[model samples]
Target: MSDHKQNPLSREMKTHAMILGSFVAIFWVTELLDMSIFRGRLDRFGIIPHSLVGLRGILFAPFLHGNLAHLIGNTIPFVVLGWLVMLQETSDFWIVTFLTMIIGGFGVWFFGAPGSVHIGASILIFGYLGFLLLRGYFQRNFASICLSVIVGVLYGGLVFGVLPGRPGISWQGHLFGFLGGVVAAKLITNEKRFYS
Candidate 1:
């Protein structure tokens, strides 16, 4: 009995870890390639607004980064918040990630400067932050609400990132990523019932 119960729980833990780890690995490997072999040429794949060729960046930009500092800055928040989002349900991770990419990516593609190239995982970071912060309110569950409070307390500073004041910063990505989270929370969590 004990072994059987532990098996499922252990499997879940492994799956959760694997999923988050894969995302991190992709980011790191892509950055490594861009820095070493590609010579930063991969950055051109990032979002460029209003150009047909640039539209592909919406799919690729989240994996590319401006430099090591940018990738490092995004890595922690991306993993931490992503794992937290997964805690609700493993599937929630995929839903949130897809929505964040599509919504957040397209938002940048639409609103970003014509000549500018936006590259970084900050879009997903802000997406995870936004989903975590708003999910509780939309779901109206005690645990989710508590999680939101904790997330807010710890990462509330991320709100400032959505503003457009910083140079070379893609505030549009941050803002849209956050909004994507909101959209995910509203669409996914509202129907979920925590209590019988």
Candidate 2:
């Protein structure tokens, strides 16, 4: 009956939640190891603009952070927005995340100042924010439109992060990460859900 139908959906939700939680857990664990065993040296793996050696950082940067404060600041939004993206379709999370890292990381690598390293999950965060905010406009679905409005109202101030002027901050990552999200939104459209 109704209970049988709900059970499968509930189990799927749990699986999606676990996947999202595991990703955040990896961030925390990476930070802990970097702080204790690596003694902050792990940050060198972060994206360094225009250098061949720095190119490897494009794969590593999002997992690295400058300090506890930086990591903490990024964790909440990463979890919340990340969860929101998964709610529509769990696979979108992987697609959006991969796109953000590649597109956003390349932006930092190409434009980031010499001798500077850019790191942190904020790039993915801004990318998620961008995807969530714009997905509705592209899909023209009522639920997505409503979700976009809520995301905007709750996280609107993040728009300022895209602008240049924050010393030591990679506005390039923010700008391009957001663009990456828009690209994700354009590329992936949600399949119709039974519940919706």
Q: Could you say which candidate leads in TM-score? A: 1
The per-prediction CA RMSD against the true structure, in angstroms, equals: 1.9, 3.1
The global C-alpha lDDT for each of the candidates, from Candidate 1 onward, is 0.91, 0.89
Which residue segments of model 1 deviate by more than 4 Å?
1-4, 193-196
Error of 1 at 165 (Å): 2.1
In terms of lDDT, model 2 sits at 0.89
Q: For residues 115-139, could you state the per-residue lDDT of candidate 1 as single tens digits?
A: 9999898998899899999988988
Q: What's the true lDDT of residue 196 in model 2?
A: 50
Query: What are the TM-scores, per candidate, against the unseen true structure?
Result: 0.94, 0.91
Give the lowest summed-lDDT range of ten residues in model 1.
187-196
Model 1's lDDT to the true fold?
Answer: 0.91
The clash count for each model shown is 0, 0
- Residue ranges of candidate 2 with Cα displaced over 4 Å: 1-6, 190-196
